[model samples]
Target chain A: MNRTWALYKKEVRSYFVSPLFYVVAAVFLSLCGFFFYSDLNFFLQFGFGMDIIGNFFQLLFADMSRAMLITVPLLTMRLFAEERKLGTIELLFTYPLREREVYAGKFCAAATVFLVMLGATLLYPIHLYTVQPYAFTVVAAGYCGLLLLGLMFIGVGLFVSSLTDSQVVAGVGSVGLLFLLWSASWNEASGSDRVMGVVKAFSTFEHFSNFSKGLIDSTDVLYFVFVVVFFTNLTLRSLESRRWRGRR
Target chain B: MIEVRNLRKQFGSTVAVNDVSFRVQTGEIIGLLGPNGSGKTTIMRILTGFFPPTAGTAWVGGLSVEADSIAVRRLIGYLPESVVLYPDIPVARYLRFCGEVKDLTGNKLRERIEAVIEAVGLGEVRHREIGKLSKGYRQRVGLAQALIAEPALLILDEPTVGLDPSQVIEIRNLIRNLRGQSTILLSTHILHEVSLACDRVIIIHRGDIIAEDTAEGLNRRVQGVFQTLVRVDGPLPEVVGALRSLPGVDEVIEDAVPSDAATRLRIVSREGEPVRKAIARAIVDRGWSLIEVSPIQLTLEDLFVRLVRQQPSGH
Candidate 1:
């Protein structure tokens, strides 16, 4: 556990030191601010009797959810790919820590960065609160759902990064993969419901929808956790396979 | 201590390392000398627990590389052939990170990082970003990373590959200074580097260890068939016949030049023979002035070439 934290600290520090973290954070915050202003203007023009905080959050959640499918890949593309390219992967493997510890350390660090980005978007709610004191519970729940969804996508990006040594390839490949998972339920034919049911079950956005609607379902939370764990396990296995394949 | 038995690694149908085995006692510097693609890095990777052998097993510090890889990894520090670091990071911060990965923290981590930085001569550029440093400094940083943990075993694969002449000398001196404190297994194709730093040399070719002995031992083995060049003022035919009849003389080949004021005769002798003295005596007995009698010495390059050429016989 000490080794895990050591790795986590180093990884988090590395993210901050590199330009990727700052660039991604700046882009994400700007997009969130733009979406929040646009949503507010739409609510004022429509004179929708519904709560503006809830409506703005719903819009923020949807836009950020899609934005995450893009930004998560950028965040995770260099996690393993840059390590391999820079020959630090071999150095890391020589440490006494287990593969699981390394995986968890990096996973938590990237998730933390994602959470921080999401946290910055809280300004939209604070602004809404100035106009009308909204239900803080709904805002909190929506943020939780967004975080969980982002965590799942980050896992997918990390797994993709482990598959290749080129950061560009990892980044593009992760975006393509996340896009597929995000839109898995696009086909809505009568016979496609059966397929959509399974797809929706695996869709990261589907699991997040319940949370955005101010509902906390244990099953939905479990789905996100299981997906994160499942992909992280796959990343570990991929690293282990390199050992047997004698490519290290 | 390190022990490897019948280690083999195969990538698909091609064998990268085949039935390779060797051992290193504590405080001994061993060199794994091989040509390109001769499994030097593969063996190092397996020994360091970065990877496992497809067949056979290896133990480092009494821990199995396959079963107790984490424990084995703790005992070894590895420097890959191409040392690539995070260029954006400051040198000191990078070393601290390495210390952390090796399970050192708090005061211990700080002390170790400072010690390694000083040991590798990175004090001047400790705060500089790695990318801005020169090649020599970058190589020093790589060395510092390996030595920060101060493991029982250190594996360096072509550590001096891309360095300039002076940089190579500095790195070599650093490695030489690490002789007794840490057991080292360095791989290189530069024969002189092995002769300068390693106590025992293992020469591998085509995924097999063809020669394993001390530098002197390898030279002695290759020098078995001694050749002496004698320049004398005498009859070439008579000198050749007399040298051939000697007990240790295997075959004497007469040069193209006829016997004159300065005639050169080449004499080949069996192993463990001092043919120079016998040739001198024969020339003196015949009342001919022997101008020069020199026994040819086989250098490490000659030995490496002979060993590599002989690899086809599967020795």
Candidate 2:
């Protein structure tokens, strides 16, 4: 197969082989299940007079996004950091493959595993589907938003992982950066209108809101794409800088 | 094939490699000999396209390392010092992974993997986790990983550093078997390893290419630091003065093992000067029975120390 695909397979298999993957996935799934149950329970309790279905999804996805913002770093912390700490990045960099291929392969691999983790939460919706009819279009839109948001988070996480050989540092740095990106607009009211607008536009939380409401904005889609591409490019350059730093 | 032109690498103020240049013909095994911190690893890194030189250029397989690094990397199979493998990955699977990264696939990848596995004598442990293997086995696996891609140039930095004596011989034999297949540039301070395995030795001291010659040629070059043990049947002071007065002779040190009849003198010659003929003649002229006059054959170890001592401090 393709070389990038080979790396992707190795990365994916690596996750399954390590206990860290199972622990992280199990904890993430348990949290999601608890949130899904709470959302469903609230819908069942206070549903006689309100848009319970919409409320259920709004809470579910928002919680999923926040949980995933935290979870992405845990999964991605080992991508480049572990390879570097183990000195296997030397092997990877010595290969004929371009730097971008390595970054893309790793990003795609982590995204794939993230998708698998996200896929587990689909059981909740599947259960909901069997009980009461929900708008398929709306669910698709929410998923598109969730996938894009997760991709951006993965890109950022991977980039952070490239900066250090310590996985803990990558993990903590990614969480802090993701939190900043997610809440950049939180204090915008005190700023000038133009500054507030810029902050809101930059905030991932702001961009993701429309998607959770089943609205597909091309601007939001482009924003996520931009984040992924930008961070992946940075990761490519990060690998190049390693040469200057005499890491090999 | 490799050619480096006036390469220089500076890490901040400390110059790691200084104005070093060399060429290697295809299929020649060149041993890069250097003391620790002698910049051998840095040079290998530059050649392998792991990093660009702070100045100068290198071409591997006719591809410029700076402009065509990916292509240069394609032609090189590099085993860095202390080969690090993924602890969790099995040897066979890891090799296959590396092969695939080199764009090998299908039947060719499988065949090459099999070949390198047997070549490195890692067939038995191919299915074991790399972390669990012995150092020698891990080293073999490292070699197999580099060999799997079948590149035109193989750059191995201290491939046998931590192995036992028998393992060292095994790895040396493995490298020997690879001759004529790929141009191999291996770096090590292990002198005997160069003498046994390399066609030529490039001695780098203080980030400089102090000497480059065949193993025998290097021995001869160090032979310039002339030291010979002479046993003469004569008055000790007379023999010492006559040997010291001889042309090209620098000093005459008497052996501490006091001899009753024969005077054992260690004659050291001036640099780049051979004093054997003069010392032999002087002893004959003095009517002393020249029992023995043999130029000390400097082992690579002594040669390394002698060369190192001749150079000023690196810093």
Candidate 3:
């Protein structure tokens, strides 16, 4: 377990040093910060001493989660893809660690980096608090929702990364899937019964809307948990399949 | 320290390792000799639990590799072919990560890293990123990572691959110095490496194990004849007759045509059974003078060539 922790630290360190993390984090945060600043002018009309947490989260969380849907893949893409490309996957699998342990290490690493990236945006909320104190409970719930969504996205990205040696393929492929899932929840896009079925099973944006409003529905929680578990299990299988498949 | 029985590995339709079997005793240095695509790497992978054998079993430190893959991995240090490494990581950091996975921590891990760096002569480039290092230094990094655990079994696939002659010698001496502390099974196409470093050899060719024995033993088996060239100043037929009648003589091969007053005869004696003393005495006993007699010894290269060139059973 300590080695697993060590492996997790190593993976996180690898990400911290990689340009991909900085590029994604900087781009995502600056874009979000610009939008958040623009929204702040309009939000101040609600007046002082009012608990604007409800309205504050409703306006910002949707775009933040959508932004994360695209950028999380960039952070997770190199987790296993680069290892496979360099043939260091052989070194990893042949270690005393189990397949699931390796999977957990990578997943936790991407989650840690994602958490840190998301944590930087806490400045926007803190800026709102300095002006006038607001109800902290809804803001906390909204953050929990973003964390859940971010973790699920990381899991999906990690799974996609496991299937390819090309980081480009992994990043593009996971981004494509997550964006498709987010778009499927649109009102007019679900016109077809087939699209409705997809929306029912995998629509991440629809489940996240309730969390942005600070209502932690069990169904929404379960959906995020299910997606995380499903993709993580798939990644574990992908790791095991290497031993069955020929060559590195 | 290592035992493989009837191991077979197939990459789809192509069989890479076909029912191969060999063992490495504790403190023994064994060479897995073969050319490219000869299943040497496959066997090492299977032994290291990198992948399961399509069919067969292997034991490392008395634990089944398939059944106790994790435990087996803990007992061994493996250097894969090409020694694929993360280019971005510095040498010390890479070894520290390797040491960590084996449950080493704190001062113990630091000291082990220092020890392996010293052992593999990687102290100079320990702080450099692996990608920036040259081939020989990269090799030392690889070797250092493998040696970090001081494992009971060290499975190396082409340990000296792509290194210059001097680097090869340095890597070899590094391995040679760990003789009694760890058992090693290294694969190499270089024949002299086997002769100089390995106590025993298991030769594989085309996915099949062709021969397994000590270097000298394989040499004797392949030769099966200890040849000695004899030059005598007497009748050719008479000399041949006398030499053929000597003890342990397999047959008499005429080396070349008779020159002037002397004739050359190559005496084929049973392998590893010396007939030189008898041949010398017999030549001098008679009035015929003994001009020359020298035994031709076969090298590991010759044995390797002979073994691979020969056909496999039921092939």
Candidate 4:
């Protein structure tokens, strides 16, 4: 565990020192800011009687969730791919570390970056708080939902990164996979409720929606947790498989 | 403290490391000499517990590589052929991270980072970003990381592959200075390097141990006969005939050119024969000035070629 954390800290410090992290953070924050302003203007023009904070929560969850599908890949693409390309994987394997330590360290580092980016989006809510002193529970729940959704995206990104030694391939492949999962619910509408139900069960967004509406369903929480654990386990197995292949 | 028995590794039908075996004792520097694709890196990987051998067992620091890899890893430090580092990281930070992975922390970790930096001559660049440093400095950083843990065994594969001549000498001197502190298993095809840095040399050819012994011992094993080159200011036939009639002289070959004031003759003799003195006496007997008489010793390159040729073709 100590070794794992040491690797985690090194990875995180590396991200901060490189330009890649800043580039991704800049692009993500700009997208979130644009959505916040556009959603606010649209609601004001429509003059809806619904709560403004509630409307912003909807926009934040929906658009930022899609934004994550784009940026999460950028964040996790270098996790294992860069190490393999630079031949540093051999050095890491030579250390007194298990495959689990490396996987957990990189996973936590990427997830922490995602969490920090999500935290930056809290300014939109603070703006709402200034306008109206409303209950904070729903907003908190919505942020929690975004966090869980981001974790799942990170997991998928890490798994994709492990499949190849090219960061471009890992990033593009992760985006494609996340897009397919996002659009999965549309496949079940044409007289296939049973198939649609299974698809929805696997769709990460479906589980996320319940929390965005201020509902923390146990099933939804378990679903996100399961996805995170499942993908991390797959990443670990992929690393172990490489040892059998013996190329390194 | 390392032992291997019948180690074999294959990817599909392509064998990378065949049935190979050797031993390394404590405080000994062993060089794994081989040409490209001779399974040098594959064997080192197995020793470092990076991969399990397909059909054999390797023990390092009294721990089996297959059974107690974690313990084995704790006992060994490996430097791969290419040095790869986090380009964005500072030198000190990177060394600290290596120390941490080696299970050092707090004051011990800090001390190791400082000591390794000084040991590798990286004190000037300790705070510099690794990406901006030159290749030589980067290699120093890699060496520092390997030594930060101070393990009992050090496995370096081509540590000076891409360095300039002076840089190579610098790294060689560093390894020489580390002779008594740790056991080293270095792999390289640079024959002169083995002669200079290693105490014992193991030559592997086509995935098998072709020769293993001290540098002089291996040279003597393949050096069954000796050849002497003599230059004399006398008639070529007289010099050649006189040397040939000597007791230990096996054969004598004289060059046709006598135009340069000195005639050249090569005399072959059985091993352990002192043919130089005999050639000098022959030249003096003929009242000719002997310009030079020297035994032509087989260099490491010649020894390597002879060893490889002695191996069966299927190997």
DockQ of each: 0.64, 0.61, 0.64, 0.71
lDDT for each residue of candidate 3 in A1-248, tens digit (9 for 90 to 100): 87788789889888877787888999889878976876566567763344465555677887788778778999988888999999988988788989888888888888898899999999988877886677767877888899999998898899999999999999999999888877776775646988687676678888888888888999999999999999989988888887778656
User: Where is model 4 more than 4 Å wrong at Cα?
Assistant: A52-54, B226-297
Residue-by-residue lDDT tens digits, candidate 4, B1-315:
999999999977889889998889999999999998899999999988888888999999889998999999999888998787888888998998899999998999988888888888999999999989988889889889989989899999999999988888889988998989899999998887898899899999888899999886786789767778888888777777887898888888875464756888777777434667777887788799989887665688989999988888888
Q: Roughly what TM-score does model 4 have, to 2 decimal places?
A: 0.89
Per-residue lDDT of model 2, residues B19-45, tens digit only? 999999999999999889999999998
Give candidate 1's TM-score.
0.87
* Number of the top-ranking candidate, with TM-score as the measure: 4
Cα lDDT, model 2, residue A37: 93
lDDT of 3 by residue, B161-189 (tens): 88899998888988899899899999999
- Against the reference, the lDDT scores of all candidates come to 0.85, 0.87, 0.85, 0.87
Evaluated on chain A only, model 4 obtains a TM-score of: 0.95
TM-score of 3: 0.87
Docking class of 1: medium
> Native contacts retained per candidate?
0.82, 0.77, 0.72, 0.77
Measured by lDDT, the strongest candidate is: 2
- Docking class for model 3 is medium
Between candidates 1 and 4, the lDDT winner = 4
Clashing pairs in 4: none
